[model samples]
Target: MLAIRLVTAPERPDALVLPIRPTGNAEGDGPRATLESSLPAVADELLAEAAALVPAARATGRAGEVHVHLRPGRTPGRLLLAGVGEADERGWRAAGAALARSAADETHVTVAVPGGAPAASVRGLVEGLLLASYRFRLRAADEAPTLTGVDVVVTDPAAYDEAVEAAVVTARMTRLARDLTNTPSSVKNPQWFAEQVEAAAAGEPDLHLRVRQPDELAAEGFGGILAVGGGSASGPRLVELDWRPVGARTHVVLVGKGITFDTGGISIKPRDAMKLMRKDMAGAAAVVAATLGAAALRLPVRVTTLTPLAENMVSGSAFRPGDVVRHYGGVTSETTNSDAEGRLVLADALAYAVADLKPDLLIDLATLTGANAIALGTRTGALYSENDQLAADLLAAIDAAGEAAWRMPLPADYVQYLRSDIADLYSAPTQGAGSVVAALYLREFTGDLRQRWLHVDMSAPSWAERDDAELSRGATGWGVRGLLRWLATLA
Candidate 1:
């Protein structure tokens, strides 16, 4: 974690980041002059030097554009002109990410905050700065350099205190999700994942945890979970974390697919696809992390997070294709494709949540299908729900949290694809709209609460192909921020 301090003025830090707005937004002649007037007299020369480099670097003060100026003997020796387009939250977030990446070597840095910056913009900047600096590596000696601290130079630090604190909590929780997702399968089995959740819930006020083992799962009739985890020696786990605050008005239940390692079970995947199966439980990581974030923030809403953990591996005991397994709510599902195991485990949890938790809003996150990636690409998550208002609220939360999610349809026509003669539902429907059919299958488990459910198929967005704004090279921790934001709105 990087240390962020809000300071009224710069104290000659190692690096100084200046927020540069678009051409028309800057005051006092131009961007450089405007920044110069805001800073002390010692920064005049450095600002001029940085301004000259901006055009050479082709930086038009657009978001995510950064121009660096290094002065050997000058005060605040290094300067970074980070673009905050239109001085908006999204713009500030992009600029913060760019700065974090560009100043990776700096130990301590200072940022000259834009004048009259709103709380949202401040929050976005802090989140982007911290999230972009996230790194996960398994190596000896740990020789790589990292950003240590940041000083946000502001006119009135008190005004943005709450915003900064909230940003820190959100970023830390998102990074927790990233850490869990990036861990290797060798060390991260279902039992280990459950233990991690239990450890995280420790010492947190009003947060309760329950971990159900294989025998308990079998006794309670979790056929889907047992069938899926029976192949792995480590077995399966159902982790339930509940945070009930005083006077909470709404109950939101979150279910995540926690396949710690997916070898595609009896139906094996290609070598290329199996390599990244360690991150198949990214959805579980997000929900667990978001639940912790809510507890840390002490949001006035009851949140129950359920993660069904398993390792879909190949073995003699692995559930075979054409096998019909009963879910928690007694909904039978025929295993058409063992690779579609996420929806199966998710069905058990969603059914249990609907039958028992009785939440006002139900949301499930999963890396369920490849078709989601094909439809929305790697940056955006495919959101499916029948409820219009819930969809609208979640979309708004995603926008506010600077995450990308597009609402997909739950077409009644496509529901036919999930029909199975031998079972209540087909695990994987061999139809086009693979993502839609996957969502429809999960909806069957929601019982009468289907209208209150929102399904997030985040297979692609869960893992990043490359580093970008607020995202590292591996697990992106996609849904945590948006889910936290949505919880805040409900609170």
Candidate 2:
């Protein structure tokens, strides 16, 4: 719950954060100049102290290095030097994140924005602070060294007004997603997930939300979701969230796989394998959080989200191997492995979204396969697109937002593994390239599978596995920033 504001020179801070550039970087000079003027006026003494205290520069401004000076009189407490090796958007955010982490014990701080910084870079800086300030202590509010507020000192306040606003929405949504994802599955099942989305949309004028229950899904021929969620006591839900500004020019539909818990259903995972299943719904969480954020920011694009919420569990009534389910659009699919249930639920949502919503571009996010993780690892995500331009656009979004993602081939030849003798398609392939085959399976149920569609196989489950990347050790809210930036680029 960090509060951030763009300000002038009047605000006194607990600590002053200055971005440090490497010796050889061209952009390092301005920041160095700003630091010199902001600090005490003894240059020779300061340089001696810095040489001893700061980390050795490996490259020209290596990222994530921190140097601290205690009780610099110009500031209230200490001076924090954060590294931004080359001063790109990614580096700026890394600097901000690094600064936030260095000042984690402090409640309030002021950061100096370098002279002649771009407005977009300022937004990234703010986002870094806000995101790094996140903690997952839902009940331990008193124990955590949480950041309460931040003041960003900028040379051009007028240029950053809108950028700050966007940062606010992005940061708030990122926290919201983390809060939802960090909550255990005991309290965050499919029904509860749907209710949460409904509650969030309560008073927003530009946002509309609807939740469809198990019976409704069955009646509507969404057998994939219905079957996958049949074993859970909590049942399943299809949560539709739509955000429409009055004069929006384009439509974007987002579908997220909301597998509340992945026990591998009847195909049951080993005890060790089932540990992190609570985070399996992160894709759906991203969609819910991002769409609500769009309404708050009032972006001039119509965004719709179809989140299929379900719990893949084991029971006498659970869907079994070789069971045929009739998905939306009247397409029948056979379940070869119940563990591969994410694609099943996504199948129904994707078809429903594209056919009924008729969006300009269709995107679905799912922690759908382990093969994707094997292909790309936990630090990066896998993105598959049938259209070349859409792939390129999403890659640009990944770079600008500083979220890691790599394009994976959908290779039409991989479609053969999904062929079924009993049904139109099979949920899991018989053999290799499981990630690619999973994407091919989802594309089969989508309307216009080869055009205007993008699929993000977030196999890493959208939570932080390490202490780096300015993210705390919980749900990273990976898609919120990139989706917002991509939506803003529309028109």
Candidate 3:
């Protein structure tokens, strides 16, 4: 984890020298000379002296590169030139990420943005840098390299404080989620996943955690979870974590699909796509991370987290497409496609959350369908919900958190798409309204609880090569911020 500290405006030391580029025809010497002229008065005549020592190349003002050199008479660090391409937010953010990545080994690094830049933009840049620089190299038994801390020096302290603080919290939560998702399946099975919930809730005075392992799930009639894991060597578990604040009027239930490793059972996935199956548990990771964030922040609402952890693997005992399974709430579903097991487990978990916990709202997240990726492309996920108001609130939350989410319809006319002639329902429809059908299947488990419910099909670019300021190339930690923002609105 990266520790972030702000350098107070009044307490900033004279030793610090920030690099800058010339605005117009002021270009004379190299980047070092230009940066020397831009230094504050507290830093002495070292800036002026350094201007005369460097070569005669002009500074480009790009966002990432840095050139620093010492002057003749100074004892402190040399003048440093930082890129500030076009003085725009995107440029600044990219530059900030590059700076963090370069300085990951340094004990303390400080970033100085010009006075006129938007505080939000600067903070966003810092946030992006911290997130992008995070590398999961824990598996190597040798030297464990980690970033200890960072100090951000902004011109206006007050305007950027709130955003910076929020970013810190978000970063911590994101890292937590990433670490869990990155853990190998052998070490992070369904039981271990349940143990993590218990451990996260151990010190919380108001939190309660419940775990239903394979035996317990079977006793509780969670056949969906049972059937999905019946063939796996590790089995399955349902984890429920509840946080209730005194006098809290609203209650929200969060359900996450935790398929630890998906080998696609009888109906196998392509070898190319199977490589990324480790991250199929991303939805579960997001919900767990969001719950932890809420507890850490002490949000004033009742929140229940339901995560069904399982591994879908191929074996002689694996459930086939023609098999019928009974889920929680007595809903029987026919397995139309064994690969569509995420929805099945989520159905059991969601049913338990709505029927037993009876929260005021329910939100289930899953990397349930590739069709969502086809519909929303790489940036945004598809959202479907029965309650428009709940959907609108979640969209607002996503917007506020700067995560992309789009509302997809749950047309009642499409309800028949999932109908099974022999069973109460089909795990997947024969036709290809894939994302919507998955949402519709979950809706059946929600019952008539009068609570607002949302289903998020996160089949979009959970991992990609083109990185953004806030999102890394892998396991975007997509729903953490959005979930936190929604909880804040409840507060």
Candidate 4:
């Protein structure tokens, strides 16, 4: 865990981190100048050394670049140079993450927070730091002790304090999502996930949480979730998280697809590909974290997160292809491919959210379709909504959060893609339009809602193959930042 606080300056910290702007980008001014003015002797040595390095050796002040030095007589002894390419949210966050990675061996560090930028930038920096520092080594043979108690030096106290708290909350929740996603499905099943959430909300006064097991779910006619989880021994669970504050004008409900371990059900994924299936629950983890985050930050919006959890394994009892299951709201969906199970589980939760909860706005995130990755690649997520304004708002949030998202159209004629002779809806057209058809299928359940709905496909971004920029090796926590920004925009 990361322990961060705002302080005037470092009192001999283990490391002194300075956010370095390129010679031109800094306009020859900023924190580096401030540090130089504070200690010209140290500045003389640092500049000379920086200048002596070859192009390949120079830290360049580009995003993801770092230069470390051990200054024998300097104030902090160890000095770190963090590159800030453009000083934007992405740059700042990446630089902060790079710096945090550099701090792995050291516990106490003094970080010079960027000045003059808005609170959003400050928040972004802290978000990166925590995300980079996150490591799920619980199952590792040996784990390194991590950094704790960061001493932040900032120009403005009030802005720093306000941004820091929200940033800290968002960062922790994001890391929580990453942790939940990175965990192997063998140890982290649906029941364990609920127990963790229950533990987290144990003492939080504003949060009300309920985890509905199989018997209760079957009693309530949650056939989709019940069927998708019918194969695994772990069974199925519907995790409902709520944060309701009186006098709230706006209400938002988030539905997430939670397949704890998907062997593609009766269809069955290849053995080699199932290794990363543990991250299929990234959407559920994200929505849960975002809901808890909103409650922690005390946002004025009333939020509810419905996560339909399950393990889609192949068994004699597993739901099979060509089977028709009636979901919540009496919406029957034909399972054309058992691999298309994510949308099946999501259908029940979305219907329940709309029919029973009736929120003003509804958003669902899922690792729903491989076509999403084919269409948008690993760096970008795909979002679909018939409501123009809501789509625009969420895209703006994606931009503001320095994440990637592209809005895909909901063709008026696309309903034909999901036509099913056996049921009200089929999973897909079977060949092309996997992403589009999945969203269109969800539109069936959300048809009667009084307000707008947005569906996000996180199939690619949530489980990336390699580390890039701010995202670590696994469980990038793709939706948390953008969703948080979107919620705050509504607030």
For each candidate, the alpha-carbon lDDT, in order, equals: 0.88, 0.81, 0.75, 0.81
Question: What would you estimate as the lDDT of candidate 2?
Answer: 0.81
State model 4's lDDT: 0.81
Question: Candidate 1 — which residues are off by over 4 angstroms?
Answer: 24-58
* Candidate 1 C-alpha lDDT tens digits along 299-356: 9999999999999989999999999999997889999989999998998999899899
Inter-residue clash pairs, candidate 4:
none
What value does the lDDT take at residue 58 in candidate 1? Answer: 55
For candidate 4, lDDT tens digit of each residue in 1-491? 67777765456566877665555423433322212123222345654553444133444577767788786876567777777666677777887788777778887887766455666666767877887777767654766666775776766667678788888888888888998999988798899999988987777777899899999999988999999999989989999999887767899999998999889988888988787999989999999999888888888899999999999998889999999999987889888888999988999998898878989999999999888889998888999988899999999988877678999977768788787898988875674788987888888888666249999999898965666666778788888988888888888
| Number of backbone collisions per candidate | 0, 2, 1, 0
Per-residue error for 235 in candidate 4, Å, reads: 1.8
- Two-way lDDT contest, 2 vs 3, winner: 2
What TM-score does structure 1 among the candidates reach?
A: 0.95
Between the candidate structures 1 and 3, which one is better when assessed by TM-score? 1
Worst 10 residues of 1 by lDDT: 28-37
List the candidate 4 regions with Cα displacement exceeding 4 Å: 23-59, 114-117
Please identify model 3 stretches exceeding 4 Å from their true place: 9-95, 113-126, 138-147, 154-163, 449-451, 465-468
Model 3 TM: 0.84
* Model 4 error, position 340 (Å): 0.7
RMSD of each: 2.6, 3.5, 4.7, 3.5
